[model samples]
Target: MSVTDPEPTVPTRDQVRQAPKVLLHDHLDGGLRPATIIELADEVHHELPAGDAESLGRWFAEAADSGSLVRYLETFDHTVAVMQTGPALTRVARECVEDLVADGVVYAEVRYAPEQHVTQGLTLDEVVAAVQEGFEQATEAAGGRIVVRQLLTAMRHQARSMEIAELSVAWRDRGVAGFDIAGAEAGYPPTRHLDAFEYLQRESSHFTIHAGEAFGLPSIWQAIQWCGADRLGHGVRIVDDITVADDGTVTLGRLAAYVRDMRIPLEMCPASNVQTGAATSIAEHPIGLLTDLRFRVTVNTDNRLMSQTSMTAEMHSLAEAFGYTLTDLRWFTINAMKSAFLPFDERLAIIDEVIKPGYAALAG
Candidate 1:
């Protein structure tokens, strides 16, 4: 079964769903259940483009399918609109974990900007508490089958990174895992929030930056070098720094080589990238080249509702596009678990106890 073994079978959708997966860069607001959104909207008298759950779900996917990143983000207004109150936030977070478990996710770090949820007079701390309550409720209901954590994200366009960073650190021991900065990356560079990053670093805290998605190498360079980001959220544009020669020679630019050598984690969301014009399609995604180059690349569903995806769906798509096998899927899962913001011992426990055994059973 060594060198002469036949090629491994490409995993089917159901098989992939049965395999344990780890997610590291999903958005909380972007993954609300359409039905929940409908009910919550009705409670607040908020208007929706579509009335029924099915139609509203379709609307979110179609609206996000626009190639412009800004346009893709616009679809969140409705989902965020209804998620104003504490109960609404708790419900969404609870259902989010339940959905992940059903999708075979064993571990995940879901992110959200608390600042975006304060429209109805809830303080940022209250928003965090509300979401944590939901996560805790769902985790208990699942009997600890799936481990989930909150990643507080500050809107890059806003000047509240310091506050969000402080909040993340304050709640780190409770349920929050880390901090992040997200929003349109064109005009708002990660460097704009250097004070927050510096403060986090001084406090020995962790954070990831939204970089290299809508922007190019410059954004990624700043996120890593200037801001000291622990991870690069949707660092798809790093491909621009890689050169594939006509004679099959591959050259990595200084920044790209440094990223690879340093073992920086890139949270690549292929479908979301395609939707936001970061990549042409899954077939042409830089994930293939980056994987071949041994970069610390991890797959994620940046927006589940918008991309109409789950961990299983992402793995299935990669299998069809790249002929990934169980072994390949296992590698991606382990990478995400290892790069998780949890303590090393806890991360290792999940990988060895849950991820390794689950994938081994699938492979067997």
Candidate 2:
């Protein structure tokens, strides 16, 4: 209820490992298993900065935590390089699903830029098809447990936004659930791709734009007002618009009020935020404040490998930092599930059948 109130404590690490969580903001390239990355790199003759899986994993964690967005982005260059061919893409995608299933993620939407995977002469369609095939195979192999969806992303600095948006719409009913724009958020505003957003709007396509991460409120304003983003990726800067009065009462600016009033989901990635210099520390994260204020805040792992985090780890950190209880975790999980691009009926079914019962069992 209140931020100062003691939450209903749950053994989150143990319970959450089997609690049927929903992941909404993970990047497929960012979630690659280190061992898989090493093997894939060998297949493509890609020279990795680290030779061993342990060191390679540590290298990613260190590079991302270096507090420079440019350097953090550079790590993806290697992962993306190895993912050029069909088999490589399929293997990574399939393994991603398996990893999520192992982590107790019942439903997940993995986002990746299809354009980035076509460097080896494969078409964009081929990339999407291959990833979809991998997801299907993984789901089957997972014994019908985890449900994975693909969200096609367009690189922010690129000029192919409209093409990627059209591609997302084209594959809407075929495993692709939504569209997104990611990459450097400072100079490349979502407004630069107005044509793509307009096309997606007309096509009734779903989209979540990367905003309020490396940039500030202006980027978020443009993403929501100009580009009509359904959800915000790491909207931590929204806290910039909120202030507290001398008497200790909180005040919301026009932009913060609008976002809260509209119930636009904020995909807040705590560890990733710290890694990207978005937030200095987890204790000072706006997630606790936003959650207290009821802003449709949801936890996510934007880049698992880079941040060296899992959904369970993120939740555990929040619990340790803010003393969140099982109820709080359940609320966040439901919030993410509700905000997902899945059909309303299907989303409700998961909430009612899977998530609710799972959390109830945890509480018991």
Candidate 3:
């Protein structure tokens, strides 16, 4: 009797990490190395919740998992405090790119607010320059293996949005990919930054707004309709527009229908959603429904340090929860690439060359 050996099977983590990925909603300050944070904090005399790198990393994870938005926002204070000067910003940005490269990310757009990093006597322009320099340094160090872009972000509650928007426009050719507005969504809505959005639109620039995570459909509606967002950040709350009948019929509300028809991308961060109380668990997350319905959905790690997640971990969790295969993971990667702020030709080239071939080899 001839017996066939079982097919090779390894942890999904290995497969997911080997796949080329595209990330569009990551935060620079949110992805720093724990040891680097401690060192930087030490240089600046900034107080930290934990003394050692291991304890500090665990502290961030636990604090973020507390299910309190207030506590979640509090974590950034520590990270942002350490990233004040040019060298500190350069180190963080360089390490951020190196980390993404190690995670097998072929392309990433990291967003940060220059206004937040200007408290240490550096001009907003200097902060942008420092971060760009770091990105350049990382690119050389990677031997040009990865492509990194910046999304100059403006805090929604702050008054420097127009300035940030203009800065993004000015740096369009110099590593800045687009503009973004991020902050607490409860009291400060996207509408508060209408002028900034209008300016970006007029300049033929791209911008994504944080919406539909902590808030509801109204926030998403304003981001898409009023603000003309190119994409939705953490748009998990858009699930409210979807209804399932007892008879197993799925119906899309008008807003949902519009979003699906328009092919708008949803930057869904499953781990971050769970940490922020957006969803009770990954199994119950709306990503499964949205993916089923063929929405333009992209998986992202919104805050790596806070969520204690990477692309590999996020894909592993989703695969375990939803029974995803290499094909499903490839679909999410392609969706993100197609929705990237890069030009159509560049996005298409990566999808056709890197992403497609990389997945094909793994799928085999």
Candidate 4:
């Protein structure tokens, strides 16, 4: 699967859909189904930009493709508006799991800021509880095939990071698996939440920070050195510090070398990168270079609804753009499963029993 190889034949949608996948970076608010959004909005008496499901879906895709992050993020306003109640939150979470199961995602960690969903008088703890209940019900309904975990996120520009971090630790044994900081990456750096990061560190809690997406190496450097991030959320800008020589060799700066040597997982979202202007296009994404250099790269759909992407679509695009094989896809899947925030024993069990065997079957 070298970069110079001719583009591989694109896999059919069905073939890609059936291949077992692992997703690490999907957002709960960003992945609501359009039909569900319509129903929920109507129930809450919230007006939407589009009247029907199909038009709403098209509107999201078109708005996200407008080459502006502000425009892209604005679409979430409608989704968050209807998700303020308990029933709506639970229904969305359960349906999200069902959708992932149908798309062949065996393991997924969906993230969201509990603060964003409390506008309708729901407490933060209540919001987390509702989502957890929904996930448990969905897993049971799916016959225990798909495993879902929640990563509680704190809005970076807000001042409630420490509160959210504590809330995440409180729900660790329930359904919450990790903590995260998300929002504008350019103006608000990870260091802004140092108190929250320190509290998480003291509690021995795990967290991944949003860095290197809209910002450059400085943000990534601070996230690693200052905030102590375990993994990078859409850390696409780490490539800025790497220099490729004329002889086709690569050199890494201090920060890049530290990240690679430490094996910090990079949650790279290809289609979302293009939508958010993180990358020019999928073909020019740094994922190919990072994978070739063994950077512990993993693929993800940051926002399935807004980007109009899925785990299968992301994998297919990577295969077509970088000549990836079934073997390559398997490696990426294993990388994500290994980097997940599950307990060590459970994580190893999935890799040994489910993910490895699933990929073996696909290879045959």
Evaluate all candidate structures by whole-model CA lDDT and list the values in order: 0.93, 0.91, 0.91, 0.90
Q: Kindly report which residue stretches of model 4 are placed more than 4 angstroms away from their true locations once superposed.
A: 1-11
Superior by lDDT: candidate 3 or candidate 4: 3
lDDT of 4 by residue, 1-364 (tens): 5344232345566766787889999999999999999999989899989998999999999999998767788899988998999999999999999989998999999999999999989999999999998999999999968889999999999999999999999999998999999998878988999999999999999999999998899999889999999999988898998999999888999888999999999999999999877888899999989998899899999999999999999999988887687777878999999999999898888888888888667656
Off by over 4 Å in 1: 1-7, 68-70
| Consecutive 10-residue window with the lowest summed lDDT within model 3 | 1-10
Candidate 3 lDDT, tens digit per residue, 69-160?
Answer: 77888899999999999999999999999999999999999999999998989998899999999999998899866889999999988899
Give lDDT tens digits, candidate 2, residues 1-364.
7344344564558776777788999999999989999999998899999999999999999889887767787899989999999999999999989888888898999999999998899999999999999999999999968788999999999999999999999999999999999988877989999999999999998999989996899999999999999999999999999997889799999999999999999998999988877788999998988998899998899888999888888988898898887778888999999999999999999999999999888767
Candidate 1, residues 1-364, lDDT tens digits: the string is: 1123244888889989999999999999999999999999999999999999999999889889866656676788998999899999999999999999999999999999999999999999999999999999999999989999999999999999999999999999999999999998989999999999999999999999999997999999999999999999989899899999999899999999999999999999999988888889999999999988989989999999999999999999998898888888888899899899999999999998998999878777
Regions of model 2 farther than 4 Å from truth: 2-7
TM-scores for every predicted model? 0.98, 0.97, 0.96, 0.97
- TM-score order, best first, reads 1, 2, 4, 3
Global local distance difference test of model 2: 0.91
Question: Where is the poorest 10-residue window by lDDT in model 1?
Answer: 1-10
